[model samples]
Target chain A: MTDRTPDDLYDALRDRLADYGQEPPAPLWAKIRAQLPPPVAAPQLRRRRRRPIVLLGLLLTVLSAAGWQLWLVSRSGPAVMPAPQTVALGSNAPTNAAVASPASAGPSASPKLGKAALENPGMSGASISETKSSPSTATTDNLRLATQVRPDSAASRRSGPYRPQPAGSVAGPFAGGSQARNPRLAVLSRSARVRYSAGQPSLAVGSTDSSVELPTAAAFSTSGSEQGRLPVDVVVAPSAGGHKAVERSTAPVFGPVAASATDYAPGAPASLLASRPVAVLSPALPQPRVQLRTDTFSTAPAVVRRWTVQVLAGPTLTHQHLGAEPASDPSLPTGIITYLDSIVNEFSRRERMSTGYSAQVQVRRVLTGRWSLSTGLGYQEYASQTTYVASTSTSTPPILSSGVFDMAPPSPHRSTYRFLTVPIRFGYALGQSGGRLRYGLLAGIDAALYLGGNSAGKEAVPTAWSISGSPYRPLSASVSLGLDFRYRLASHLEVLAQPTATYFLNSLPRPLSGLTPHHLFGAGALLGLSYEFR
Target chain B: MPPPIAPVDEALLAACRRGESAAQYQLYQRLAYRLLGVCLRYCPNRAEAEDALQNTFVKIFTRLDQYRGQGPFEAWARRIAVTTALHAVEQHRLRHPTPGTDPDDLAADLPSAEPSALESLAAEDLLALLNTLPPGYRTVLNLYAVEGYSHQEIAELLGIAEGTSKSQLARARRLLESRLATQHYQQLP
Candidate 1:
C-alpha cells in the first residue's frame, strides 16, 4: 500500500483529503486586521506615495532666472587649491607674489624664514609647503598662513642671473610641474643680503600700492624672447618713514593676471606672464627674489571667522495618506469600507504619488576643515490627487449600492499641502580648496511646521460622485540626505546643485484609521547660488 | 455534480451577505481551514496560502449578491479560493520568461509513469509532490486534474493560449510521475 504509484493514491484520496495541516489562517487574519478598516471605524492607512515630476519647466526657470539674483559665477574649470598652513607670518605682514604670478608659488616659507634666507650666505632653506590639491580647505590654520618674498633660499642661492623663463619652465627642486614661471628670477648672487632699512615691504605686482605706475612699452626695454619680454623697470618708493607714496617706475608694474585687466590694458605690454620674477629692489640690495603665492585670497580667510548663507530649491518627492472621509453604506458587506473603497477604486481613481517642491535658505558656519553646520528656513509644497463620488438623489445620501455605475463620478482631481520647514544639516565639502567646482555631502533632521494648507475636493453635485477634501495635520518631522555640487564663479559667488531626499516620521494627512499614520516624504533636486555674506 | 447548499449554510450565507459580523465569523471558521488547504497546494508556503484564503473570503462575501443559488455555495467558494491562489502566484511577478521552445516537444521528452503510488500517499505527500512543480505547472495541473477545468477553460481563466495550458498540465504530470516512480522504487528496495 505504501509503495503504490501516485495515480492509485490520488484516485482513492481525491477530494477526500481534509485540511492537511491544522494551521489556521492566523497571519492572514492579522494582515486583514491591519490593512482592512474596521466595520465601524475604517483603517486610515495611506497607500499613496509621492513621485517627482520631471519638471523640466522648473529646472529651466531656475537656470535662466536672470532677474532672480542668484548672482551666478562662471566656473567651467578648477580653481587653484590653497597650500598647507606650514608657515606662519606672525604679525609681520608679507606681500603675496602669487596674486601676480599664480604658477610661481615657491616653498611655503614664513616671512621670518624668507628673511633668514636673505641674511644667511651659505643657507639653502627651500621650505616649500606643498600646495594642497584640494580646493575646499576651510580650516583656520591654513588661513593663518601668510605669503613670503620667495618660496625658499634655493632661489636665493642658485647661481643664475634673473631671466624670464617660458610658461613651461621647470620648477627646479623648489617645486615641480609646468606651472606659470617668471623667467626673470633675478637669482641673487649667493653673497647678497637683501633687507629694507625703513621696513619697506617687499614689492610684487599685485601687492603694489594703487598709486604704483607702469611705463609705456616704448619706455621699457625687453630683454627676453618676444613672447616673454622683460621690462626693465627700476622702481624707487619713499620708505614707510615717509608718509608720501610716490612711484618712480619707468619700468612696467604688472600683476600678471590682474594686470591684463587693469594695469596692463589692451596696448600694455603682454609680457607680464613672461616678465622677470619681480623682486623688491630695496633700492639697496641688488637682488631681492620674490615668489608668487598662488593661494586665492579667499583661501586663508579662516581668520575672517565668517558665517555663510546659501539657498536650496528643488523638486522633492514623498507620499501621504489622503481622504479617510468615507462614503460607504452600512448595507454592503464590511459596510462603509466596502462601499467607500469601491466608489474610490472602481469609479474615481486616486493618485498614490506625492510631488512637491522644496526651497530653503540656509545659514552655514564652518566648524572645521571641510566640515560645516547649516540650518535653514524653507517652504515646501506637496500635491496628491483623489476623486469624489456623490449620489444622484437630492440630499447627501450615504453610499447605497455596490454598483459602480450608480453614480458617474468626475475624473481624477488633486490635493495640495504646503509646509514651512526648519532644517539643520551637517555638511562636508570635498574637492580642491579653492577650485571652481566643488562637491560635497550633507545630512540633517528637520521640524516642518505645516503652514495652513488648502484642501479642494471635487465639488459634489447631487447624484454625481466627487472626492472629499483631504484633511491636514499641523507639523511633521523628517530627515534629509543629499549630495551637493558647487561652482565658484567668483571669490564670493558660487552656484550650487544639491539633489536630496526627505523622509517624514509622521503622516501628513489624517486618514480614517486612528492607529495608522500616513507619513509623507519627498526628494528634491535643488539648484541655487550662494554669495559669501562677509 | 457539486453538492446542494445546506439550509443552515443558506441562512448563514444570507446573514454574511448582509455584513453580519457574527455570521461572517461563523462562515469563515467553518470553511477557512478547508479553503486554506486548497490555497496551500498552489502557494509557495503556508503564509501566502493564508493570504489567498483571506482574499477568497473577502471576495466571497463581497460578491455574494451575484452568487445566485447556482450548484453549491462551497463549490463556488472553492473555485474562488483556487483562482485567488493563482492570482497571488501571478502577483509574485516572475521575471524573464524564456522563448517557449515548443511545450509539446518538452512534454514529449519527459518520462511518464502511472502515479499509482498516490494510493499510499498522505495529504502531506500529495502537497509535497504538488509543491515540487513550477508555479505555472502547478497551477495548470491543479485546475485541470483537481478542479476539473478543461484546457480551454484554464487558458481563458489564466490568460494563456489553450496549447500552453495543455502543455503545462502534461509537464506537471510528467514531473509528478517521475518523482512518484523514484519514491516507489526507493520504497521497494
Candidate 2:
C-alpha cells in the first residue's frame, strides 16, 4: 500500500475502533412521547371555571363600596370654626381695602360687627365715624388738641391714670387734614386714645360699653399733619356688666374745635370725630394684625391626583441598557445585540400569556434637572390558548394467529388548551421633569415560569418514518425592544405602560409533529404602577 | 423507500415526546456513556469532558426536532454532541487562551523523560498522545483520522478552508510522530 490518503487512514482507524455499546436509557422513549401536547378540551370547560371567579370579584367590590359608604356616614360631623388663642384684630378683614369700605359701611356692617365682636370682643367699643371740613380754623384746633391729648394718654396709660380719650380728639389732626375720609378711618386714626380693657387689649373709643375682640385690625392717616399720630390699639375686652354710650357726634364742622376731656372705662363704645381742612394722605394703611402662629394661615400640603392612574395603561414602557459590561479588551470577542434580541423573543413566546396583570417597581437616579434614568423589575401573570394536532398508528395481528396480518388503523386528533404564565422582567426608564408624557426604551432579560397549564408539556414530533424522534428542543431564548410610557400620578408615583415585540433566537418545539422551524413572534402589553423614592 | 425505517428509536422517542419523567432518566443513562466518549476526545481533561457530555445531552433533548435526516440518526446525534463539545472547548479557549505549555510540546517532553519504550506502549498511552495535541489540532485530527471525514468536508463543517484543514492535520500528525520518536529514543537509555 504505497501512500494511503488521509481518508483511507481514517476509514481504517474507524474500522479498528470499538463500538459505543451503550443503549439510550430505557425510559427515554416514554419521556419523549410524554412531551407531546395533550388534546384541546371544550371551551365550555374554561367558561365554567371563569364565571364563578368573575361573580366573586363583583360581589367583593360591591361589599367594599357599601362598607366605605357606611364608614363615611358615621364619621360626618358639623363644621365649626376653630377659635384662636389670641384673636388679633382683622382676621376676617376684607382682602381689598377699597372693596371693604362700602361693604363695611352698608347693612352688612351690622352682622359683621356683631360677628367680629362675638368672635374677638376686643375692638367692639371702637366706633368709626366720617367727617367733612373747611381748610382755615380746622388746622389750628385739630393740631393743638391731637398734640396735647396724645402725650397725656401715652403718659397716663403708661403711669397712673389710664384715661381713654375720645376717638374724635385723637383723630382730629389727621382726619381734619384729610380731604376724603372713610368712616373706618376714624377708628384707625384715633386708635391710640382707644383704651383697652383690663383683662386684655380692647379698644374702647365710645361709651357703648359693649365688649369687642379684634382678631386683626389696621389704621390709616394722612402725613400732612405736623404732629405725630398715636399707635393703633388692638384689644380684646370682657363684657356682660359694661357701661353703655350713645353716638352723639356726627357734625361736619369746618371751624376751630375745642379740646374735650378723654375719659375711658372698660367695655366702652369706640368713636371718631374730625374738624378740618384738606388733608392729602398717602395710602399707607396699617397691616391687619393676624395670629401668625395659627394653623389657619399655614399653606396646604401638595396633593396627588387619582387620575394619574390612567398613565399606567398608556402605550410606552421599556428601557435600554446592556445586561453585562462591554468587554474591556477589544481582542476578546463580543456577541451581537441581535443575540439578545433573539433570546428575548423566544422568552416572550414561551411566556406569552403573562401580560394581563403585570406590576413593576422602579427606582431612578436624576441625571439632570430635566432627565432621570431608571431600572427595576416587574412580574406578570397571563393566560394563553393553544391548539395542537397529533397522529398515531396502531398495529394488530389478525384475530386468529394466521400468517397474514391485518392492517392497523390510523387515528388523528386535535386539541386546544390553556396555560398560565409568570414572567419576570428587568428594564430601565428615561424620564423628564416637565414633559407631559415621559418616554424611554428598555432592553432586559425576562424569565418565564410556567405556572399552571397544559401547554408546557407539548413536544414536537417528526414526520420522518425513523423510529427515533427529531432532535429539536424547546428552552426558548429571546430579545425584545419595547417603549416605556410613564405618566406622573403624584410627586413620587408613576404609571408605566409598555408594548413590546420580541423575536425568539431559538426555534421552539411546535405543538404538532413534522413542522419546519418557524420564527416565533410575540407581542406583549404590560401595565404597571411604581412609586420611586428618588 | 421501504416506509423510511424510523430514524429514531420509537419507544424511547415516544417516551421523550410525551414528557415522561422516567423516560428522561432512562434516555440520559443510555446515551451518557457514549456521549462521554465523544466529549473526552475533544476535551483536555475528564472534568471538561463530563461537562460537555451533560451539555450535549441537554441540547440534544431540547432541539430534537431540528434533525432533518440528511445523514444517519447516529451521525445527526453525534453532530449535536460534537458541536456541544466544541462549544465548551471554545469557551475554555476564551477563558484560558495561553493554557501553559502547548500540549504538543508537553506530550513530546513527557515521552522524552519517561523510561517507557514506544513499541511496548498500551492503548491508553496512545490515547494520551492523542489528547496532548492542542484543541484546534486535536479536533481536526480526530475528525479526519478517527471519524473518517474528508478534508473538504471538515473544512466546510468547521468554517475553515480546505487548505487550512490539510495544514492542521499535517501539523497534528507531525507532533504525534515527534512524540513517538522521542519515546523510541528514550527507550535506548
Candidate 3:
C-alpha cells in the first residue's frame, strides 16, 4: 500500500473530525432568549393578497361582447317603397258615405250573370222586397243566367285601378235594419282597429282596437285617420230565397288580376312588398273592387284582417351607474348648470355599478286596436357588490338603511347571480302598426329565479371575517322592472331595447356581524329582435 | 475525585421543559460545548460561532414542543446549532462584502501556525485543521463528512449546486491530505 487511495485518505481525515466538540463563549443562551417573538398561528412570514380578478375578468368580457352586439344592432337597411299605396281612384270627390251592405252583393264571376238581372236599369237602387216575380220563374231564370254568362269574359272587364269610396260616405250596409231582416248579412263593428296589407289593404275593425294595420303595411303606413272598413261597396251574397237586386261598385279589384292570374301586377317589384306586412287572402275571395278613374297600379283590397304574431331577437344593454338611482326630471328648473353637472358626476361613476347580461326571445300578441300584450322567456345574469368595514372606534354608530358601503371597511364583498326570467309586458301603439316609423310604450315585470352565485362573506378579509351566520338567501325568485322601446325594420322584423333595473328582495348580511346589511340593485339594458308570424 | 456523575439527560430535558431554571442551565452546560464545535466548523470565527450557539439554545428552549423524541436530544440540538451557524454566515455575507474564500487566498494571507500537526492528533483536535481551510471548503467538508449529508443536501443548505459542493469537499480533503503528509502525529504545541 505504497500509494494511498483518495477514498482511504478522505475516510481517515473524516474519522478524525467526526467526534469534534468544543466549548462556546460565555453568556450565549442569554443573548438568544432576548430575540424571541410572540407565538403566531402559523410560522409563515408572508401572506398573499389577491384582487377580485375573476370578477373583473367576467365584467370585461361581458362589456366587450355587449358593446360589439350594440354596434351590430345599430345597423339598419333601406326598405323604402315609392308605389302610392291606398291611392284613391276616380273623379268622384270622396263623400263621407256610410258603408253599403258588403253582404248584399256576391262577386259575379260572369259579367253577364248579373247583366240579365241588370236588364232593368232601375233595379240597382231597388230593395230586395220590391222585386216580385213568380218564384219558379225567378229561380229558373237565375240558374240560366249563371250558365249562359261566360266567366272568362268577366276577366277582361277588370282592366282598371280601383276607386276607394269614402266608407262613411256610402250608406251603411246594415241600414234599414236589412241585416236583421236577413240573417246571412249581419256584421258587427267593435273596437277601433286598422288592418295592414302588403300590396293588399287590411282593415282593422272599429274602436275596439287601438292599433291599426295599414295596407302596404311596413314601409307605407296609412295615417291612423285613414283606418276603417273599406268604403261600403264590397259584394255580398243575397238570400237563396229568390235572386234580389244587388248594389255593386264598378271598380275592379285589380285590372292586372286577370292579366297576371297571380292577382298583383307582375311588373311591381317584390322587394317593395317585403318591407310591409303581407296579407295572405284566401284565393277564393277577391278584394271588394272599387270603381276609380285612370290610375297606373292596383291598390289593396279591403277585407277583415287576421291577428298577427310577432317574434323578435336582438342584443341589448343597460347600466345604472354605481351608487345611482333612476333619474327624475326636476319639478322646477335650476339656473345653476354647474350644480347639475356635479349631480350627474356623482351618479356617473363606473366603480359603483355592477353590470350583467341576458339573451331573450319574445312573442307579442296584438290585441284589440292600439293595445297589445307581450310575453317572453330570457336567460339573464347580473352581479352586485357590498362592503364591510372594521370599526376602530369603540363607540358604535347607527347602521344606515340606504346602503352600508360608505362607512364600511376597506374590504368589498361581492355577490353574483344567474337567473332564468319570464317577462309580461303590455304595450300601447301610438301610430299605425305598419308605418315606417311607429311608436309605443311598454311596461313589464320580469319574474326570475336565482341559478347560482357567490356570497360576500366568503371573500371578506381577516379583519372583517366574523361569520356566525350565512349571508345569502336561497335561490328561488327575484324580480325586475323595465321599459322597452320598439322599432320595426321590416314586416317580420322589429328591434326592441329595454332599460331594466333588477331588485333582489332578500337582504344579505356581511361576514362581520353588525355591519350594514347588503342589498343588490342591478341596472342594465336588454336588446332583442322581433319576428312576426303573420 | 469521585467518578463524574452520569448525565440524566432525559430527566434534565423534562425538567427544563417545565421552566425549571436550574435544569435548563444543567442541560445547556452539558451540550453547549459539543454544539459549539459544530457551529465553529461552519462559522468564519469564534465570536460568530458563539452567537450562533446562543441562538440555537434559545430556539431549542422556545420550541421544545416541536421535539417528538424519536432520536437522541443531542442530535436534535446539534442540527439546530449547525443551521444557526450557517444562517449567521449568510447574514454576515449579506451585511458585508465577502473577501476571497478560495484556498489560494487562505494560504497567502493566513500563515499556518502548525500545518503538519494534524494526522497523528486525536480526532477531537482535528477542529484546528478545519479552521485553517477556506470557509466554503470547510463548510462543505463538515456537512458532508461529519453530518453525513449528501452533496445535493449540502448544496441546498449552502445555496450552491451539487457539483460545487463536491468540488469544495474534494479541495478541502486535498488540502488536509497535503498538510497531513508533511508531518508526524505529534502532541499539541
The prediction achieving the highest TM-score against the true structure is 1
* DockQ-based class of model 1: incorrect
Instruction: Score residue A438 of candidate 1 by CA lDDT.
Output: 84
Residue lDDT tens for model 3, A1-534: 122234555565556655566765566655544443322322231221112234334644564455445433322111222212121111110111111111221122123322322332222222211110111122333423332322222222112111211222121111111111222221111111212233333321111111222233222122222222232222222112212222222212111111121122223332222222222233232223211111101111111121234343333232222223322223211211122223222212322445557776665655435555565677765554443332221111111111222233245544355566665566667767666556666665555544555432211211121121233332323346666566778866667776665665443332212123334556666666666664
Query: lDDT per residue, candidate 1, A60-141, as tens digits?
Result: 3443353122211111112321211011110011111111111222122233233323233222222222122111231223
lDDT of each: 0.46, 0.37, 0.41
| Better candidate number, 1 or 3, judged by lDDT | 1
Candidate number with greatest DockQ? 3
What fraction of the true Cα-Cα contacts (under 8 Å, chains A to B) does candidate 1 also have?
Answer: 0.16
What is the C-alpha DockQ of each candidate?
0.07, 0.06, 0.13
**What TM-score, computed on C-alpha atoms, does each candidate reach?**
0.31, 0.31, 0.29
- For A130-182, candidate 2 gives per-residue lDDT tens digits of 11122212233332222122211222222222122344443222221111222
Pick by DockQ: 1 or 2, better one:
1
Number of the top-ranking candidate, with lDDT as the measure: 1
Worst 10 residues of 2 chain B by lDDT: B110-119
Off by over 4 Å in 2: A1-534, B1-8, B99-121, B184-189
